[model samples]
Target: MIGKTFSHYKILEKLGEGGMGVVYLAEDSKLERKVAIKFLPRHFATHSDEWERFKIEAKAAAALNHPNIATIHAIEEVNDEIFIVMEYIDGQELKEKISKGPITIEESIKIAIQITEGLNAAHEKDIVHRDIKSSNIMITEKGKVKIMDFGLAKIRGGVQLTKEQSALGTAAYMSPEQARGEPTDHGADIWAFG
Candidate 1:
């Protein structure tokens, strides 16, 4: 990936790569602050569906200003790349922590509690997080839990999934309803918790 400035943000360091794109821990020169920038991979850059969903993710994520949600500052298109500028959290991804090992039952429950609260808020607005897992949960330095990747989120009356009996969610975290490709509602999240 290129390490060029997007508007006022100066790419500081490559954070980590994901299936969709490369993430960078950047510095917002204008604001003199830090932010995380996620770039849309070139292959998907021209996909209208992904682009549209990215917009929806921006709107959905920006809607919730809660402490448990990653704060989205702006979503922009620089040249041929799409990037989302989010609050730069100085902490490890929950999955990274889990990778070092599993958490205690009590700690796991606490983390789940915070996530459930955020999910409930989004669900109340009819937003479904199609992808939810330990990897997408960000733990801030101050012990705050923030959910990420509302990118795959489905909104009410939103786009339809393809019909090949295909599943479009994180395999491990997917609820049975989602896994089975059945119609689902808020209950799906509860099932995911199981």
Candidate 2:
């Protein structure tokens, strides 16, 4: 989809793909700025459950306005293709950095602080980010920590999407309650954070 235009955003290149969707770097013609667009995989697009989960992700993230959390610009659909436009973050995943070597204690503290702040904001809004792993955290060139991906987020009082007994987050990072497919609250986030 490189060089293809979707509405006002022109796809520049593929950024990455996750269980939820494929992300692409795009240029917004209207805003004259770069944006990241996430498209639900075609295979999952035809599934109502997956579509609902995708929409929930957009809704959950869009409701938050925090510097440490990647900003959601817009959710759009064109020719039956649904995608979410987000602030283009120029950075590497935390996972990639950790793979290099151990970070300095001071640096780790800073990153942890920023992540906690972001999580606080989400929790204040009653949004529990069930998936909180290194891969979902981005570290910009400026050392800013921005949390990404809310595909498994659970918004309080929101519609139930996942099936019973189905655990939904990265296994390695999931809280015990999450791994067991039990009901979780903000405490679950604390466990994962720890």
Candidate 3:
């Protein structure tokens, strides 16, 4: 995708890949800003259910605005290629920090507080972030925490999106109720936070 122009955005380089799709660093020529674009995999795009969920992810996160949360810029489809444009965050995944070594108590407390604050904002909007693992949390170079990937989030009062007991979150961070394949709520996030 390098050098390819999707809409007004020019693909620059690859950021990473996940189960949902590959993320790339792109330049928004219209706005003259760098953005992160996550493209839905062609295989998954062919699947209707996953496609729907992909759209839902954009909606679910687009409604939220918090410093501790990554911002959603736009969801676009160019030539059957669906992608999400998001705030380009230059940071390291929280999981990597932990793996490198133990963090200072002060830094740990700050990160926890930021995560809690971000979750509080989501819960206030009746959104339940079903996944809250370390990898899903980002620590910016300036020491700011930003929660990302609301792809598995469940909006309260919305239609059930996933199968019961399918365990959408990482096993180590999943709540017990989620593990049992039962319905969950904000409490599940709190459990993961603990």
Please say which candidate is ahead in TM-score: 1 or 2.
Answer: 2
Each prediction's TM-score against the native? Answer: 0.87, 0.97, 0.95
RMSD per model, one decimal = 2.2, 1.0, 1.2
Write model 2 residue lDDT over 1-194, tens digit each, in one string. 99999999999999999888999999999989999999999988889999999999999999999999999999999877799999899999999999999999999999999999999999999999998989899999999999999878889777776899889888887888889998888888888889
Question: Tens digits of per-residue lDDT for model 3 on 1-194?
Answer: 98899999999999888767889999999999999999999988888889888888889899999999999999999988999999999999999989999999999999999999999999999889888889889999899999988878888888677766577777787899888878889998999889
lDDT of 2 at 90: 93
| Candidate 3's TM-score | 0.95
Candidate 1 has which clashing residue pairs, if any?
Answer: none
- Please identify which of the two predictions, 2 or 3, would achieve the higher lDDT against the true structure: 2
lDDT, candidate 1, residue 138?
Answer: 88
Error of 2 at 4 (Å): 0.9
lDDT of 2 at 126: 93
Q: Write the per-residue lDDT of candidate 1 for residues 84-133, one digit (tens) a residue.
A: 89988788889898899877998888888899888888887887777777
User: What's the number of clashes in each of the models?
Assistant: 0, 0, 1
Give candidate 1's error at residue 33 in angstroms: 1.0
